[model samples]
Target chain A: MILTNIESVPGLRTVEHMGLVSGSTVRSKHVGRDLMAGLKNIFGGELKGYTELLNEAREEAIARMVKQAEALGANAVVNVRFSTSAVAAGAAELYAYGTAVRVE
Target chain B: MADIIVFIVLVACGYFIGGHRERSHYRSIFAREAATLELTLLSGKAIDPAWQVAQAALVTGVCVISVDYFKSVAAGLRNLVGGRVSAYESLIDRARREALLRMKAQAAALGGKVVVINVRLETSSISGMKADGRSGQVASVEVIAYGTALALA
Candidate 1:
C-alpha cells in the first residue's frame, strides 16, 4: 500500500475516498547505546541505537496502517503521515495514518 | 522506632498498590474495539446496522475505561494528605486529546465527512520489573482511531 503524509499523492488520483485508516504500536529499546553514542560524540560516532529504534517503530506503524487499509477493501492508502510520542520514559508510540482510497 | 518503620511500610505499600491499580485500570480502558461501515455510491443500499452497533460499543468501551480509571485514582488519593493530583490529570488529558486530534485529522484528509464506526483504541506500558529494581508503570496510552467513510449516490 502506498502511504504518504502529503495531502495528495503526486501522480495517483483518488477515485474513491474509502475513509480513514491508521495503525500504531508502542515500543522501546535500551537507550544505553544512544547514551554511548552521545558520549562518543567527543570524537563523533553514529547513533545506531536511536536510528534503529526509529526505523523499527516506523516500519511497524506502517505495516499496521496497511492492514487497516486492507480491511477497508482499499487497494491503496494515500496521504499517509507518521507521528511519534514518548508515552513513557522508555517507550514510544509510533503511529501511521492515511486516507484509504481506490485509485484508477 | 517501630511506629516509624510501620509508617514507612504503609507508605511503600500505598505506592505499590496504587501504581499497580492505576496500570491495570488504564489497560482495561485501552482495550481494542474495531468497527466498519460500508457506503455504496449507488442508491438502494441499506445502511449496515452492524457498523452502528460496533461504533457504539467502541465509544462506550473507551469512555468507560477512561472515566473509571480517572475516578478511581482520584478517589484513592482524596483521603491521602497530598498536595495535588494535577500531574496525572495532565498526563491523561494530553494523551487522550493528542490521540483524538490525530484521528480527526486523518479522517478529514481522507475525504470522509466524519469517522463513523469501528474506532479502535489500544493502550500499553513500557516498563517491566527487573533485577535492578525498576518499577513498571503505564507510560502511554495508544488510541487507534479507524472508521469507514461512505459516499451515497
Candidate 2:
C-alpha cells in the first residue's frame, strides 16, 4: 500500500469522502531508559531502547488508522497527521488520523 | 540492638506490602483483556460507512511495565545466582500483544485486511521535574499501525 503523510497521493485521486479515520494508543516504556535519554540529549547520539519503543508505537498506531480506512471501503487515507499526549505517569498516547476516501 | 531489629522488621514489612500492591496493579490492568468481540458485532452490517469508520477512534492504552531500578539491580544479582529473568520477558510480550490487539480491532472495523508498511512507534516521558533538577519522568509509548485496502477490479 502507498502510505504517504502528504494529503494527496501522487497518482490516486480521492473520488469520495468516506469520512474521518483514526487509530490511537497509549503506551509506556522503561523508566531507566527515560533517564538515559535525558542524559543522552546533552551527550548526543542514538538511544537505542527508546528509539525502538517509539518506532514500534508509531507503526502500530498507523496500522490501525489504515485499517479503519479500509473498513470504510476507502482505498486511501489522505491528510494523515499524528499527535501525542500525556495520558498517565508512565504512559503516553499516540494518535494517527486521516481522511478516509475512495480514490480513483 | 533493638533499634537495628526494628529497622530490619520495618524493611521486611515494606517489601511485603509493596510486592502485594504491585501484584494487584498487574492483576487489574495486565490480566484483563479488553472486549474485542464488539468490533465483529458492529461490522455485521454495511451501514453508514462514516460512522463505522469513526469507530476506529477508540483509544487503546498499552502499558510496558519494567523492573524498577532497585528491582533491576536485584534481578541482575539474581542472574549471577543463575535465576531466570522471566518477568522482563513477560512484560515486553504483554505490551506488544496489547498494542497489536488494539490495532487489530481498528483494522477490523475499517474492513482492512492487515496493517502494513510505514509503521511507527513513539515514546515520551510523562513525569514532571524532580527535586534534583532532573525531570521526574513517566514513560508513555504509542504504536501506529497503517496499511492499504485493495479492491478487486
Candidate 3:
C-alpha cells in the first residue's frame, strides 16, 4: 500500500477522501525481558528488548491501518500520523491514523 | 562501608558498560553517516520541484534507551541541586541518533534516495509501574523517528 504523510501524492491525484482510519495497540514486555533490560539500565545504553517490543507494536498498528484502508476500498493512506503514549508503567500505546483515499 | 561499596560498583558499571556502548555507538553513527552521505534528510514541508515523486511511503525507526542505575542516582542528586544531569544528556542523544539511523536504514532498504519531508520525532518514557507485579521504575525511554520516503519516477 502507498502511504504518504503529505496532503497529496505527487504523481497521482486523490479521487476520494475516506475520512479517517486509525489503529491502536497497547503493549509491554514480559518479566524476563524487563529484568534483563533493568540490568542493562545500570549501564545506560540501548534497551534492545523494549526497542523490539515497541517496533513490533508500531508495525502491528500500521498493519491494522492498512487493513482498514483496504476495507474502505482505498488504494492509499495519506497525511498519515503516528502517536505514542504511556498507558501505564511498563505499558505503552501506539496509535496510527490517516486519511484513506483513492488515487487515480 | 556497604554504601561506599555500592557507590563504587555503580560507577564501575556505568563506566564499563554505558560509557563503552556510547562511544561505540557514536563511532558507528559517524561511519554509517559517511556511507549514506548521498541521501537527503530534511525537516521542511516542501518537496523539490525538480524531482517527481513516483512513489511515496512512510518509514519509521524506534529506539529505547535506559539510564544506567548510576546515572539515575546522579540525576536524582542533581535534581536536588538544580543543575544539568550530564549523565542523561548522552543517553537521550544516543537514542535520537540511533533512531534516525534506523530510519535511514529503512529508507535505503526500500530503494529510496532521500527522506522528502515531514520528519517527526516522538519520545516517551515507558518503564514504570511494572505490569508484572515487579518494581515500577522509570529508567528507559522510547524514541521514534518517522518521515516520508519518496522515490524518483
Candidate 4:
C-alpha cells in the first residue's frame, strides 16, 4: 500500500477516509546481545545488533498497521508517524500510526 | 592492582574499538553520503510535486549506539571539566546517518525513487542493564528516521 507522512498525496486524490490504523510492538534485547552491545560500547560506533532489534520491531509494527489499513479497504496510509517509548529499563516499544484512505 | 589493571583494559579497549571504529565508520558514511548525494533526502514537511511522485510510501530507519566503559568514564571526567564530551559526538552522528541510510534503502527497495521527503529524525535514550537507577547515565541511544518515499507515478 502507498504510505506517506503527508496529509495529501501530491498527484493523487483521496476518495475515502478509513479512519486511523495503528500498530505497536515492544521488544527487549537478549543478554547475549546486551553483552555484545556493551562490549561494542567500549569503542563507540554502531550497535548493529540493537539496531537490528529495533528495526525488526519497527517493521513488525508497520506490518500490523498495514494489515489494519487493508482491513479498512484502504489503498494507502497517509500522514504516517512513528513514536517510541521506553517500556522498561531494557525494553522499548515502537508505534506506527496513520490515516487509512483510498486514493486514485 | 586489579583496579588499575581493569582501568587500563577498559581504556585500551575503548581506544581500539571506539577510536578506530569511529574513524572507519566516518570514512564509510562520508563515502556513502557522497555517492548518494544525487538522491533527494529532505527535512521538509510539504508534499512537493516537484518530486513527480507517482507512488509514495512511508519509509523508516532506526539505529542504536552506545559508548564503551572508557568513553563513559571520559564523559564523566569531561563533566567535571565542564566541557564537551567528544566521546558522545560520534555516537549520535553515526546513529543518525545510519538511520537515514537505512530509511533510504527501504525506500529504494520498494521501487521508490531515490527521492524521500519530509524526513523526520527523532532521538531518545534507552536505559541500560543497570535498572537500579543509580547510574542514570544514558548508556544507549536510538535514532529513528522516517520520511515519505515518492516514486515516479
Q: What is the TM-score of each candidate against the true structure?
A: 0.38, 0.41, 0.92, 0.89
**Best-fitting candidate, scored by DockQ:** 3
Candidate 1 lDDT tens digits, B5-71: 8656554543464455556544533442112122211112234543321111011111101112333
Q: Between prediction 2 and prediction 3, which has the larger lDDT?
A: 3
Query: Which order, best to worst by lDDT?
Result: 3, 4, 2, 1
In terms of docking quality, how is candidate 3 classified? medium
lDDT of 3 by residue, B1-153 (tens): 999998899878987777788888889989988998777777766888888677787988899988777777777788798887787788778888889888888887767555557888987556763434243665775789888888775
Model 4 in CAPRI terms: which quality?
Answer: medium
Which 10 consecutive positions of candidate 1 chain A have the poorest summed lDDT? Answer: A38-47
Over the stretch A40-73, how does candidate 1's per-residue lDDT look in tens digits? 2222212344434544665687788888889888
Tell me which of candidates 1 and 4 scores higher on TM-score. 4
Model 2: which docking level applies?
incorrect
Summarize candidate 2's per-residue lDDT along A44-68 as a digit string, tens digits.
2233455466556667878999898
What fnat does each of the candidate structures reach?
0.06, 0.10, 0.81, 0.71
Please give the lDDT score for candidate 4. Answer: 0.78
Q: Best candidate per lDDT, number? A: 3
Residue runs of model 4 more than 4 Å from their true location after superposition:
B110-113, B124-138
**Candidate 3: clashing residue pairs, number:** 4
